[model samples]
Target chain A: EKWASTAPRIASTRLALHHFDTSYSLRLGALWPSVRAGLLCEQKYGALLNNFAAADHVPQELEPLNAADFVSEASQKAQQWQRGAAVGAVARGCQEGSGEGRTVMQAEMMAQAEMMAQAEMSPPLGASISSKIKCYTFPRGDITRFRPARPDSLGLLDYYLMDAASLLPVLALNVQPGDFVLDLCAAPGGKTLALLQTGFCGHLAANDISISRTKRLYQILHSYVPREVRDTVSVTSYDGRDWDQVKGGTFHKGAGAGSVLLQVLVDVPCTTDRHSATEEDNNIFHKRRTKERQMLPMLQLQLLMAGILAAKPGAEVVYSTCSLSPLQNECVVERALDIAEAQFNISIHVEDLSHFRTLFQETFSFFSDCRLGELVLPHLTANFGPMYFCKLRRM
Target chain B: RALLPARALPAGPGPCPRRGCGEAAALRAAGFSQEQARRLLALQPRLGPEQREAAAAQLLLLGLSAEAALALLERSPALLRLPTERLRERAEELRRLGLDGGRLERAVRRSPQLLHVPRKRLRAAVRLLRERCLFTAEQLREVLGTCPAVLQEEPRTLHHQFQYAYFRMGVQQKEMVKARLFQTPFAELRNRHIFLERRGLYETPHKGQTQISNPKLKDILQLPEEDFLASLAYSTPEEYEVFKKLLAREEEEKEEEDVDALYT
Candidate 1:
């Protein structure tokens, strides 16, 4: 009904009905054109193409089929799509343009060899706390094929732009390398280009209260840095809960008197799953998941209380989001760790990113969700994302 | 914005609809923002308005800034359906590989799939690192500016990763381009250099003498196999997963004796 529950059986029934007129428009708010005219009705396109060719044998209560289970599952997927187009027109001889490009490159190499045999049937690394968090997945075949697909396009000796699961809350914000970090809603800036590719930040402010997404985060920190490592970066637009009164004074008065504001990230703004309120093109899937996801958890607990009041009393903020929504990730990091421990008396600490999974080795994959942090999800890991992050400390 | 759907836009933007004008006033007079030129012309609506003024005048004739070509097409929207004479022939083949002009616009703003790969797969990975990993063209331009996905690999898998780091870990092609060893994964650098050359903690350097103690291929491809088993294989992660399943059953019995010596 809601286009038989949010499409995604990895595209095909004619490109998932042309990604339901460009990525599921109006993501069902105002019953999206009566659910796109009951999914392009011609008597419900043979029970919505046999419920998306038995989207891996349905049942996540997507409910609705029964006219004898849609005429016996559309004649058993029209006899397995006529035995895969008669073994691809007898292995390409009846040349209907190289038999429909060898049946769409043999159904995209049998869906990438059944998603690499379901990522080699998961469940292995034991002694469980989610087997001490290992999900890596970048290029993962041919060794993260020289990584950099923009996280401010690598330079200062390719430090770390991110997505080996956003380098586990920048290795749980143990940032140090002249530490001063802050990101706080830093637009499209992949975690402030992974905290200025860690070339020992002695200062990095970055913000994004949208002056056109902080001019696309100062053209991703002047495209892969260097102008003296982008003159120790600053780029702002404020309103990260009035970033310590727009840096006028005393946010733990400059790195002294028991220093603070070392690392921050916050990374809020959510209801994401990268458009798919049916991307037929995109009206930003009902303006970012239904009318700007109803005040996204009070603006994600006011940017995790302006990244725990621009940290200092014992810095390290992290927070993060991409949103699969546990009320925008663990009820906004458990009400910003009970308002940074009872209305800023502070003394914080959360840690347990599976005790730094043997110091971030098997390229990090942590999902034991919300006792504070960790989650990567994308159908339980592969190309590591749908982030969530967590980690705090400021005792 | 009641989520528009009168047959959701196909031909709209042409006649000034309000707020900024044509091609959103030529992308807000070249520095975007009329909502980042209407969210990068609504994420490439087959880039009309004269292909977004010839892809922002071919990214200001490849010197960027028109807000860094609308922040590199808001971080590579498949480089605006490519073809600006194949983005000026992949920026003149990354300035004939010595990467000129701000290191070829920071390697095409950090990998715009290194300008849609294929130019004979970046000249067969720069002719397998200059004729079989002998490197030195300024050590393969500092290993293609510290790993530009080794110009999209496969010149016989970068000549079997430089013949397994120059003949089974005798290394040195400037220590395999300062141990970025074409960014690891010739089966996890032959299962961590044959599990530290079968635990005698490495050796192999001959002919130029110095035959025993070894380690640095950048600490065996950047450590963390549980800190290379608590600092150099004093071992355990269940004895390095039973020495990576006995070196993957001795590479499937040496690829079944080279397919039984190419069929006897």
Candidate 2:
């Protein structure tokens, strides 16, 4: 009854419901309820992979499952609704080249480390990132009756649904095919519609400082790009720490740095823990947004020093965040590499994406509990994550 | 509209995409979350009463007032993320206050001047920059975020410009806040610290920390009095026009020795 005679409104509604479990269990010590409840049951029951880059000559290791395809019958009803996707497909079919079928499924998963398929997502993250993304997934295997919010439920649909670990910071920007890229907090634009479904960028801009999330990132890059990679993108909204790559820069102007590459991404803004452990309406644990939650690590270190001061000098940059918070991921890349070498004299580093976290540890759970970035952490059947990525180059 | 559905987003705080306005129920009762109250109402776009009278004529060129800058954005929306240059070089002071459209977040948008009494004049100029300019609550939050215009002066003219830069220019509080030294004009920082203490080329940094070759107080309050009389008091402009007429006769004999010690 009014929370037991309103003792100061039940300590101000249990201090806004233990302010997101007292801020990520004080920025995740004891990985908040042990490895943050298996990365919040893979953002509540996974499946947001959609790639179909016009189904990029469809192949995806052409249906390779065999351990007698996990004794079929639709993988025993997806292993009676996932028995650790049949012990993570008998641990990626004992990392496909049986060392006695991964020492007898690692001694029957360390003699039943007590199962719910030991809180799914992570076959001990394939012993930690053999490395890390790209544009697509079906030759009809990860299955899709198409519905993550029905992209016109199918007709001339194509695909996007996203979160294949937020496509590893735009597949750790290997965007070669004549690169220019630049996403820079591009709004709602799923990595500028998966960096124009890797029809290899050559010139893309995107940007967003919210003119209505740059008109919902121009209605998701004009509804999941195409018209010749949406006529080499150009959208803008500015105010990303006064964007300007270098003296009126936008796309590797008058190209050179050993023949042009430029990329960028920067995906900042954090404390999203799946929109703060399931929305309390802008809940930065609302004790009137405790100084905007200690000024979200200096606004993700000034939008990663405005995407490394709009990089161009050997640019590659990646910097992602959904935040499990090591003060918004490795101290905002160690205070943006000491404010990009003491106030923009410019110099950047950090590249080993650990083989892109051992090539998306059979579709993500990553955690090496960060030093300079690579986080994923979501579980219960690989539900794409509490993602935190990192990669930088600019010298 | 990638064919909508992340639980149907249009919850609106911008372009009323189906009500839920009233500033997203006053930013979800000031905790924010109809998606950070629609990205803090799409970083404030409402202004139209002619862009809140041209953002109160661009916050009257930073001297405030077009109705006390629309009554301090209806009394302190956390001075919309302060940092108005004096925090020195935050991306070159937000690119010189993003040419007018920013006195750091378009003036203000209603937050809480710590529940009113006009924050007792910014908590009496941040408790006189933490007890008579000793500063440090992280240098009074980088001196109220790089000079929140010393909250409209007059607390005895900001205690006579923090007592002539902390007692007759012995300067400290980290070189009067890394020489933003109240943006020069406590009568041109006491006519450039009495023209470098009448060209014996200055000393004052006492209290036994001994050492005052003096000059770089941002080159004696940001150069130009002909580069502070040729390279910081090496002296010229005809000996700075004979030390501004002997410092205007020692400031008219200290206001005639405070009216002859107030009538002997």
Q: Best by lDDT, which number?
A: 1
> Which 10-residue span in candidate 2 chain A carries the lowest summed lDDT?
A66-75
Q: Write the per-residue lDDT of candidate 1 for residues A1-395, one digit (tens) a residue.
A: 76876654443333433344343333323322223322221110101111101232222222332212222232234344344444544654654556447767767647444323322332221111221122222321112122232222232222223444554565456676577887878876755665555466787878788898788767656654667766777787878887877773543466546443567878887745433332445433342334455777888898888777778766778787754456777777788778867887776787655433332323333444345677654321123454678778767
TM-score of each: 0.22, 0.21
Per-residue lDDT tens digits of candidate 1, residues B1-264?
575554555464533466326777787777666766766676666555766667767766777656666777777777787778887887688678877766666666766678788788898889778887778899888788777777977788888888878877777799788887877778888887766654435656767555456878888888878997778755556545645654576688789999999998
- lDDT at residue B172 of model 1 (Cα atoms): 75
Q: Give model 1's DockQ, 2 decimals.
A: 0.01
* DockQ of model 2, rounded to 2 decimals: 0.00
User: What's the number of clashes in each of the models?
Assistant: 12, 18
Question: Which portions of model 1 show Cα errors greater than 4 Å?
Answer: A1-136, A139-166, A171-191, A194-219, A222-310, A314-350, A355-392, B1-200, B205-264
> Tens-digit lDDT track for model 2 on A1-27?
765653343233234434545566565
Most accurate candidate by TM-score: 1
